[model samples]
Target: MNNKLFSVIFSLAVAIALVGPLFAAGGGTALQHANVNVRDTAAVQRGAKLFVNYCLSCHSASYMRYNRLAEDLGLDEELVMDNLVFADVKIGETMDIAMRPADAEAWLGKVPPDLSLISRSRGADWLYTYMLTFYQDESGGWNNLALPNVSMPHVFWQLQGIQKPVYATHDGIEVVDHLTLGKPGLQSPEEYEGTVRDLVTFLDYLGEPAKVKRKNVGVWVLLFLALFALIAYALKAEYWRDVH
Candidate 1:
């Protein structure tokens, strides 16, 4: 009994040792909810437009193709070609930029990462919050609340407007508590938030274009399994009636 107790205790200790870091790692910052719905076709379409206009210049969605946009976004091939296709890329080619890696590094101090899997890698909430959190700092550079000291500039600053960090002194050190909107941009705060939400929704769809189809298939598969189980149970009952 004593040996068994020791073994159980040892197992629990090992388990706790393994699990403790995961909890510690997760305790950093609370993320704001993105509330993104990729099924909203209109929002996704708007997001796609926003991406093509603002984000595509620097970041490339290498895994996504222009024709795929027409299929997924309910856009006409002609509209996509006329409006979204800027480079000499064909309709079937993957989304790529003309900026070379060395040029990108020289211009932006670092090469921007491909955004094809960014939504999957970083949660939708993180992306949404990051997009909206850029504020003017002391060094005249933009700072993000979600990701501190981000290298990327606020490309959408014209739409979202300028924000300055509100700071409070704590123990002789000033710390940024929140942001205050300084200059009004082309969009109101509410409008900008909605735009960001739509953009995040589009990114979510880009990360997994087959997500909706997979969900539909999953539901059908579950229904078929349930029906099969019911029929099997009924057949078993019929066959075993005489034995019982």
Candidate 2:
């Protein structure tokens, strides 16, 4: 019976291991850490501005509102109305694009998805890495190290400059081993990395607006529990002392 049970458990474990990769999204190079901090209001604010300027043109954060940015990022309502709302949208309306779905599909062959929960879906690290890994391909198209043959062009190419993939033969197969920068962009590598980090931070916050508050509250709760545990231990000790 013990051997039969062990074999069954081992078989189940092996099956899970074999099936895991099939369910994983976007198999590619290892992701870089995003180091996102939702509590960093200034970083998140900068990220929000970047997203509005670049990503909002293609993707809509349909679940988020323009006025919410004013409240959360400490921006004035007038500024948000003037600068962020590029479409025919009111200040209080959700962040939606003006382009119709058919128009988007006709242009790009597929409609860009809404980005409100993208960070949660793709994870901050994957998004951060994907944003930075675009490389020039032979066909004049762009490819991503994180998601190979991706259709999206490097929209931030001006800011990030250009990179080319370095190929190497491994076990009789030529593969892109890494990327090498060809031209310098407006920002240095370190600066661009910082910018991407900020963007990821904002996306992370957008996925869960209450995360920072919950994290803060969790710290206080832990402290309270520690204090209560100490008090309870003391009371128990006192009660046991009389029994002895």
Candidate 3:
């Protein structure tokens, strides 16, 4: 029974490991790994800057405060206020946008959702791929392979340039084969990828600010457990020696 149970558990674990990436991709498109490290304060800071300049006007990170951001990224409060705080918001205030919901809905056809937990809801890999996959559709409008018919426009076009989709027939229906850069952007492809990576890294940090500290604590806890187990085993051996 023990062996049977172990086999079943192992099989389930293997299956889950194999299938997990497909679900993370969302909508059948393979996701690019974000390879983000929230512990990298410099990357997080760059991502935060990009978020504020590009995404903040539409999406608000209401859960995160400017003071907390400054503290986490090791920035002086004054520097954050001068650089990051675009609106007339106080340093202690949450990162709320000036755009009213009604106005945003009228302009965008929908109120942009708050992005405080976007990375948690849609994993970092999905977000990273989504950022990179925006392409010019036949209608000359922006579309994404990661999220078909995405309402958002290609906001990073200036940096990453225009990507045109290449289509190929598969089973009588045309499908996107790949994307090609038709126009060059300000940054090289490598530099643009790095920029997107930094942005995703910030989003990842935003989702769970305590992740770094929690991971550190977990390592210490595992070490303590191993030490305790060793001590317990030594006591057990000494106690049994007399009886033997």
TM-score for each candidate, following the candidate numbering: 0.82, 0.87, 0.84
Local distance difference test scores for all models: 0.88, 0.88, 0.92
Candidate 3 yields a Cα-based lDDT of: 0.92
Clashing pairs in 3: none
| Pairs clashing within candidate 1 | none
Worst 10 residues of 3 by lDDT: 21-30
Q: Cα deviation of 1 in candidate 1 (Å)? A: 20
The number of the candidate with the highest lDDT is 3
Please state the error at residue 174 of candidate 2 in Å: 2.1
Listed per model in order, the count of residue pairs whose N, CA or C atoms clash below 3 Å is: 0, 0, 0
Error of 2 at 197 (Å): 0.5
Q: Compose the digit string of candidate 2's lDDT tens values, residues 1-244.
A: 6999999999999999998754554755878888999989999988988998888888999889888878877789998888777677888898888889899889987789999999888899889999999999888788898888887889889988999889999999988898888888898999999999999999999999878789889999999999999999999999999999
What digit string (tens of lDDT, one per residue) describes model 1 on residues 1-244? 5999999999999999998754542313456788998778899899998999999999999999999989887889989999889888899999999999899999988899999999887879888888988888999998888777878999889999999998989799977778899888899999999999999998999999887567768889999999999999999999999899
Query: How many backbone overlaps does candidate 3 show?
Result: 0
Please state the error at residue 4 of candidate 1 in Å.
Answer: 12
